[model samples]
Target chain A: MSRADTAGSGERMKVVVTRNLGPDVMPLLQERKELDLVVWPEDRPCEREWFLQNVPGATGVIVMLSDKVNQELYEAAGPTLKIVSTMSVGYEHIDLQGAAQRNIRVGYTPDVLTDAVADISIMLALMAGRNVRETTELVARGDWPNTAWAPYGFVGPQLSANWVHPTRTAGFLGFGRISKATLARLVPFGFTDCVYTSNPSSTPNPAADAETARTYGLRSVRRVGLPELAAQSDVVFVLAPGGAATHHVVDAAFLRGMKSTAVLVNTARGTLVDSDALATALRERWIWGAGVDVVEGEPHVGREHPLVREPRCVVLPHIASATIETRLGMATTAAKNLLGALFGEAMPAEVQM
Target chain B: MSRADTAGSGERMKVVVTRNLGPDVMPLLQERKELDLVVWPEDRPCEREWFLQNVPGATGVIVMLSDKVNQELYEAAGPTLKIVSTMSVGYEHIDLQGAAQRNIRVGYTPDVLTDAVADISIMLALMAGRNVRETTELVARGDWPNTAWAPYGFVGPQLSANWVHPTRTAGFLGFGRISKATLARLVPFGFTDCVYTSNPSSTPNPAADAETARTYGLRSVRRVGLPELAAQSDVVFVLAPGGAATHHVVDAAFLRGMKSTAVLVNTARGTLVDSDALATALRERWIWGAGVDVVEGEPHVGREHPLVREPRCVVLPHIASATIETRLGMATTAAKNLLGALFGEAMPAEVQM
Candidate 1:
């Protein structure tokens, strides 16, 4: 008797993957005989109408940050949409209320991309502070003519061990998972003090926050006001979420308070900072430099962008979670979440209301 | 005028800064009116004739990597060349033997660039392993024409946190300050084991290494043979020095021994690895990917470079110490070293041969 004859045929379930995933991750779903997977072939964002049509008969949908999962999508997905798993940590695009009301489990990959994002954040910070783009452009543009030795040419801020002395400190605007991860990366660079401002939450616990800081080897991690954070920090990181509560948190006043030798890194969200204010600060030498991943308005960012035009500003395409491994892990997790919900199992990483 | 009258003119010494430094750093040196500084006016490598002509009467020379401080150049400066300070951590171009023979103290910037290099190493590793370049190229080249959903299109490796389980270990080719710092960054991501291969001269006492590992919250820090490091490590880093003792340390044999999911990072030097072998390994899937900063023949690197053609290879233009702050610090330190040595004071970071 064949092995196939020994195993009884189970009912197959339809799953729609809304975006491209990793090659290795696809085999995991493809190998399952009881699952039928429909994959989109394009590399860019999927059309809303195409998704609306395809998702109607599907048991599960796997998506990414570009795809918005709202009430319309949920309604189009109908009763068969048991799971909606996004291959990203943040699910702001997903209508949580719709999922909750429909009794459909919501799965979003979190923590998976922490290292990748943290890595990019530090890269952007270093690149922006160091004038990497300017130097690279100098080489690329073949502006080598008249190149001669001069003092104070192409110099960027230094993250010296001396900067972590008792008098110096690192600051954060909006402390979260990525900020903590970034702090862990900066610790070895001799960062001694950390002052951060987090949004006032209903659940207030100072001891837990203190304990978390201690665990991460931070000498001090105090939650302070925005003004205090700006004044004391040698390097200020904007790592808060993008929403009405924290929009333009780092304005002109905060930038002016920073040390002239200080650096600014924003990897969380672009709107968390006032780009025009940052340009003025850099132009006026209020702060040393700025590194930004997400700009106030991205993709639309052109040569005319104020930060791009500024020599001290380092602008990168919003690619914090762009690493292959992290993206793949995110895809796999998303796939597994969809499969779990479809097969009547607990979703691996579900976002509850 | 009264203070100037009190100060003596003989205290002023002739100093030639070989490269451009930060304006802030220069002000610090300028604060010492006792030093007569001759600063370079351009950002390129200094002309050899200009250096020779200027050096005859100077007490010290602050140089960059582009400037070769050889025996001939030293003799031209005569008895006046008391110190030769480089604005870089690596002093290979500087003739250590000649400096030692002349009793000329040398100063180099080290330890300062450790965090920056370590940070870049992690960036390259993530970028390569995760297919950052290829995906970025895809987006930049406008190859992303359609917006359809496809499974397994642009997925890359994600050094999953799961790999840092008790059974898994992260290995290093050379365990030095930067390696230790890199390990510290990886610990929070769940890396447990820390095995490294170092030269016999720098081998740590087994007990001390273990204790250090414990202090850093690592499961263990053990020394092993090259083969063992290759066989047991989940991710092997080529962080050893470049000279004769460790050339092509990571070759086909080492790559063959690594797990298929493992990654290799080389931020130390290009000669430490075999580029051809690495390209072959990546192509054959012997190992996952490689992140490299230094190429065997750098500056001459082009699009046709073997690693550049490989999708899994992430090549950076030797930017380990490219951070603005670190570079500025190095330049400042070099300037300080020159000023201090010329004026008969202690060098801030002198290289003890």
Candidate 2:
């Protein structure tokens, strides 16, 4: 999509923001004299009908992941809509083909969230492998006095290398930017090896893998099949993108292949793992434990949630990137993408179509 | 204690263990042809009366931290008692002066458990800083759907460095082996500065501080006063040894001076931190949050415990060194110490009186 002709014509255009992005990012949209901004005033999700009515004449729209950017929404905005910027990396809800046909450029916030997400990934790994949920609950439920420490009372697998375990291995279901960042955190824990599985059709890149090993001072960093990854990893991290091909990739067979002492952590999309299968694995002790920030059908998870019922399973709401600094970065980048697209400037992180 | 005359002469000296050390380590005692092993058969803490009865005429005794080794124990064991080996680093429960007067050597495990304890220090820091307790409880209570992600729903302070936070600082209350190991884990998180407080009576060593900084690739690693430590640190770690001199070192005034964004983690002895002061700090928001493995009075920390009731405060049972490998190492070390003293070999770790 080329620069819009409506930009800098002294013409006033309407801009709809799905929600107020707090003090740090709202000014980016409100300060524009050439654009009249209409923002949803509530702290909850913006209503669809109300959004459709306010977005009719909008030249650009800034939206959260919950706000769908579909064909019907595009038609409601008419040909005046030049772009849709989302405050998330995933754009599965957005109709890319329909937007491209209408010359609508899409912008997303991605790399800005890598470090925040990676930090939580490591946190979950520790919590899962170290019996944190069970241990903390023992204290909170007033059962600590009765459940006094025996020599092996609450013992779990150690995450870091010890005299008994001089070499540690970290595995990734998908080796992307966040995965690499998580692996970097493990180097100091004396992790000597790394195994990962990426898109199978893509050619292997040993040169890149060797360079990564050298950078982290690791003994080896090699790509492998899922079975090998499951068998070799002390901790398996599911960080692949969510979609049709990747759905339930960590299924019963994959879980069955894992070491009984291994830990599973998922910070990626919930659909990438089979929730019931994971629950069964934890129940049967096929795997040591799990820690998940994203669970299938989240926000609907309740007390009966199988993972929640498992004491060793540390289940958290989807908050992998909910840090103050990272959230501001995401919101600011999202706002800039919309402003830049409408003002004939380059979008900071545009999806190439 | 010198080489026992009873050993290897088939004199059949009695050896008493306060509690069973499990199959892996039980063989060390059971296989000694010159010894008669009498182990307390229960998983619970050995009864004091049973221990006193079984200890008479024993050449060596192995005990847990919970077992008290005092004048009564020495009198019960008579002049034949040569050593007491404890499967713990701290020996305050054992009367050192009394044991020295009785000419009994003391052995305790220390450095073998360092990595396990240090690993949990980082886990607690992440849990404290990242709102793990509140967020997990929200999901567990089925309040997630109503409290679904708004722009800033569950935001927290990030632990790792980013463009906005280019440098991260890690603070330690005591500069010791465990503190240094914890600092090594922080290097990959992009921590650039480290501030620590050690014994003030000792002279400062700039050359040693510089060497530490270089080793971790940090910009600075220097000893600071407690006030400066509270003011400058992003996360304060209490890793100092706990005793009368350091009791309640993290009092109200020190907590008030800390950054509102800083997190405090206590993996060392709980006596160093005042429970009521920490609860008030959380209530008043003087500091962000805290994660603690020990409490001022443990095994007595019920639901009403001040720190346990705080949403941001993550309290765990004292399981920092409760890992399969670490516990095994401690048990083996304790057993070896007793065997070495009885058989005239060097004890792996012996306390000097």
Candidate 3:
């Protein structure tokens, strides 16, 4: 029975929220008297069976990266589900084909997270370049008391360009919005040249690339093959989309081609980089260090993981977009997307199926 | 009498090097046949007695930050010492009055290190804001395999300006070259306004401040009092000159007035921040977090240190200027400074006593 029938009011549609959005954004969904909100009680990822059971008879669903929006979910929701809103930029977990076939619109947050992820990317680069992980570990382990100062001690390659190495080059694995934002940050660090690789399916726009170069005051910002990018870049940022075709793109050969002083930052996907190869390269001094926000099978990544064991590698728990403002923005966008789709209005950020 | 005279070549003047200047730059001084060089062989700090014994008849000395240039050292070197060249920006250890009385020129490496220090300041800011130290420790301790993903698990305040906070304000304890470079960096991250403190001895220039604001595209870059800076800033950066006047300037009262969401960064000298007060502030959540490169009594900072023990604080081993390019530049400058003062040439970066 509809909530309207039981309470003697107008018909209220059911909306399933996989997790409770915080006070700042959750009320947008909760305060909608026309909607009956069923939120997952816990802060953590909900159990699959619980989600499958709770999604029944829902007109809309608000999800996170941890949620799986597949055929099973669509079948459970039947014809009532109009939209599946996710509080993330990536929708790899969602079964887009099934959602499309079911005519369920999918909304994913993107632009709001660009600045936050870009900020973390630079943070990772600096942490890795300066040996923050190892040195901080030393201090935490109470080893700093005995270590005397040395002139060349703890010195790493400079990120900023100077008279010694006046030209600094930055490379992006996937030059998308987040990568471009990262490039903007690098401009102030004295990066003069840029290179990137986009999906092979996308056409190159030399005019647009030249415009971007001019906009950022860079010497060049061009498309380059993997080998050339590996060879030329002083710092290589992996900011591409993650999936089957791009898996292990930064394998042994790519690591071998990188300069000994070059730093590798992977804020995109763990699968794009070969963790074993990166570990071996760091151990062998083939590359200076690496800073990664995501791992191949993250949250499951332990001390035994190759990248985690790599002394020079800095691994964060996939927190590139965990900033308060970005998360709140994402949550609010997801809420708005859900509200829009359920009430027969234009979705704020609907994905193409 | 010199080594060259003993070898039947030419009379040589002795120069004492407190530490090895490394192979890349040491040759700049060693190649000069007119000088007899006495270098302390170890990579660590030179012993006081070793420095004293070697400085007896030296014409010049190349020192590091660890070396204390005092009355005793000056008396040991006697009238033969023409210059003291240090590979550091801070020269508080040097007795300026004694050096001036003896007519000994002082040369310090400054501008070369500005970028390196600025880079680390930003790194510390991000690290502290994002809880890098704690999260990375969780991964290091092998707890990640069991931990499930949660929405609010690692959320911290965002560093970027957003719709919620339309204009981010950055505060500088002392706005000098490093602070300005840091401000230039923050501009790309969407920081809209800046406030800083000038030396009490200098007159405030509203015209110059307005020019800086225009140059950086900031709303304002005005000089403010400590209390206002503490209250108004979203992120407060302690970049002041460290000595008696500036010591403990960011103590309890300043910390109390700060927003709980504000991040405090100290890439300047350690003494400018009161460690115990900061620890209390962090522990009590009076501030969001702190990222510090220097500490009140660093190198001696153990696990027992208040700031070191604070979970929210990111403490580095005083490596603000520890980048290869900057260090090499500083070494080259120190070497050239000695060469210049000894040979009647203009010193590249001499400090007038």
Question: In terms of docking quality, how is candidate 2 classified?
Answer: medium
lDDT of 1 by residue, B1-353 (tens): 23333332355667787765766677866787766788777656788888888887666788887788998788888876678888888788899999988888899998877877877666666555555555444433333333222334444455535422335578999888889877876766567788999897874689988787887787888999888898887777788878878888888898888877778888888888889999999999998788776778666556666776787876666667765556677777887787666555567899989
The TM-score each candidate achieves on chain A is 0.90, 0.97, 0.96
Higher-ranked by DockQ: 1 or 2 = 2
Which CAPRI level is candidate 3? Answer: medium
The candidate 1 chain A region of ten consecutive residues with least summed lDDT is A1-10
lDDT of 2 by residue, A237-293 (tens): 999999998999999999999999899999999999999999999999999999999
Colliding pairs, model 3: none
The reply for model 3, stretches above 4 Å from the true place, is A1-10, B1-10
Give DockQ: model 3: 0.77
Give, for candidate 1 chain B, the lowest lDDT window spanning 10 residues: B142-151
Q: How accurate is candidate 3 locally (lDDT)?
A: 0.89
lDDT of 2: 0.90
For A1-353, candidate 1 gives per-residue lDDT tens digits of 13223222344667888766756688877886766688777776777878888887677788877789998898887876778888878787899988889888899888777876777666666555655555544433334233333334555555535432323477888777888887776776667778988778745568977897688666777888888998888788888888789889899999998888788988888888999999999999999888776777666666667877788876656667755556667787888887677666567799978
- TM-score for candidate 3, residues paired by index: 0.97
Whose TM-score is higher: candidate 1's or candidate 2's?
A: 2
Interface RMSD after interface superposition, each candidate: 5.0, 1.1, 1.1
The TM-score obtained by model 2 is: 0.98
